[model samples]
Target: MGVVKDWRDKELSISEVIRKYPHISPFVIIKTDVQRRGVNYTEKALAKVDPDIHQVEYRGMFREKGDATPVSLILRDGTSILTAFSVEEGKREPILVDVIDDRIVLVDQGEILEEVEYWEKPDYYDKFTSSGKPMWQIAAARPQRIDINPNQYCQFWETPGHGCKYCSIAATYNSSKENKPKILNVDDIAETVEEALKEPGRYESIFLTGGSILNGKELLDEEVDLYIEILKRIGKNFGGKRFPSQLIGTAFNEEQLRRIYDTTGLTSYTADIEVLDKDLFEWVCPGKSARIGYDEWKRRLYKAVEIFGVGNVTTGLVVGVEMATPKGFQSEDESLEKCLAEAEELAKHGVSTVGCVWNVAPGSVFFNQMSPSLEYYIRFADGLDQIRRKYNLNVDMDNYRRCGNHPDTDLSRI
Candidate 1:
């Protein structure tokens, strides 16, 4: 076990950690910290942003929004840094984007980091859905992926106090519910995806995820049906062939998994376990814990492997949140050991794990809680990558090119 560093051990600055891990890509380390610390642009940096060619706002899954920070960032190396406008409690000084020497760089304190570019706006973003809603409202653009969030309000939030503690979905929904639909209109989704497909090579995958819908004769059945209908509509552009797509939703039973797999054109499956430690999962994701226990969730993931096939299934972890204050693991060493071990267990079952930098968002219950140190996150990402290599598991299903939110998978490019 790595007992060398305590969870509360002095945190390292971005430069210090980068110098420490020479084997890991510095771009990845910078990306992780940018996400961990959150980011905003100076007037000069924002001046370079042309809304006609750059994506200024992103919706659905929670990317920080405020006073037009240009949605998120893409490094010169193509790693996506999904910036949050504000971070929890000002735990770490927010990373800055400033124009220096006629180039945009991510700034930390007085030091300049890397030159980065804003994610480009897709050709379809400026158009409107057939329903008269802006197309960007129906589908958000990632660098090479098309993201469609069918529903924004998680059913888990419907039960007070059950939503994931680090999630802002419930809060994001309540505040915007009056303006947005709880569930998207299927026709709008199909029309937007169809229009997006017209851009040819602009998108590598079509991704769908939304708040979990827990009602049905069998749990997650309605959620399965929802995905089936939407995927079928989008699949029309593919001419009866299975499409490159993924669905991140509730961990459903084998029956539900087969229902979607047998029906839709989705090619991969992901059910975020959130935290690897069972207790941490129970504490951090109370709704998932209550509805689908830890062991049951893993069992469902394994069952997905049987259905989706090996290497096509993966789970995500909110990296540092396993050590969230109070109920979370108290020591970084212990947190790393337990999380890596549990991740290895999942890897053994053909379920590769990916880590999302724990950005303590404004609306989450843990918004005031601090995230883990940079060194801890760097080590965690390397560890998950090593585990996947050891088990011969491939994360291409959600790798850097397909989905850039995960730091661990970004290492796979090396």
Candidate 2:
């Protein structure tokens, strides 16, 4: 594949990307592009959204508003395209979601790409806990998983310039005044999970992830303790010692890893490396690099495999950040080569790599930076997917059903 000189001037469309990568799902390609360029609803499309039936309010830590806009869209094959439209200075124009022929469709450059449906609201979204806090505010839901953010604030931003360049956690946390609590009550979380489980066949797994918690007796010990407490509380709902759960927390040492693995019903573990290259890792995520060097982070992931077992432990990369200007690799080919090489090394140690298309979110340091082209993401997702297959790895915990964010993991469904 030839690299385009200017990403904006490149004429290669989603249809072309699908034709080039025939084996990769077209739905997956569409999901990647929609995520890369966020979506905005047309007046007609917005008219189609019913808050009673469709999920509208923003429920996660990322977005502050609980506005009645469509939360996200779902493709025909159950693949999710997660997007948020926040009006901010220097943000890219979103793709249009308009009504075509009496059906909702995605329009890009005056082309009707595909039909899409709004994500249905989960049953428990409307219910409130005994403490009068709305259950939906405590835990958000995807099509097949429950997302809980136990800690909403990340300590990395407390430092002058330590937070990840491609993250908007602190900005989003500070902007909104939603009634949701900063630190979720354990009982509230447990109660919400118990209520969510009542909807039979609705949820396949439970996912827990949040901003980095740097304060601890040892590094990330406080973060580990928080997860252990929440996991134990949620464990009460299950009959066995373990349940279908995944925790994407900070990279912890062996002792902290063992504490969660041994005590709770958590099944899988993940620590997002963000960017694969060592120098880029330090530049993109200075907080993580300063606290836990890139090499040590990889070491912790390997140790997690020993504790969580092969196919149960994984690391995530924000796929396109390696191409950010000034410090990132100049060429897409060089970036992909170095990234896959590092990912392959991790795969050898029983750690699988998943890709989340980097959205240059507003308020992030990289807010004005451009993400790589669509072809780059398709190739990146395919490369990571192929690596897992060669190693005979399974991404069930983060696959399409459990967590639909990763295009590489969505390929595992096939």
Q: TM per model?
A: 0.94, 0.94
Per residue, candidate 1 scores C-alpha lDDT tens digits across 1-414 of: 122234335777778888999999999999988888777668788778777778885434454333345778888888888764445245656688999999999887688889998878889988998679889889887778899999888899889889999999878887874488899999999999999989978889989999999988888788888988999999889996898998998898998899888877889999999999888888999999999999999999999999999999999888889888898888989989999999999998999898888888778898788788889999999999999899989787687777788888899877
Off by over 4 Å in 2: 1-8, 58-67, 85-92
Cα lDDT listed for each candidate: 0.85, 0.87
lDDT of model 2 at position 205 = 90
Give the C-alpha lDDT of model 1.
Answer: 0.85
Question: Cα deviation in Å at residue 177, candidate 1?
Answer: 7.2
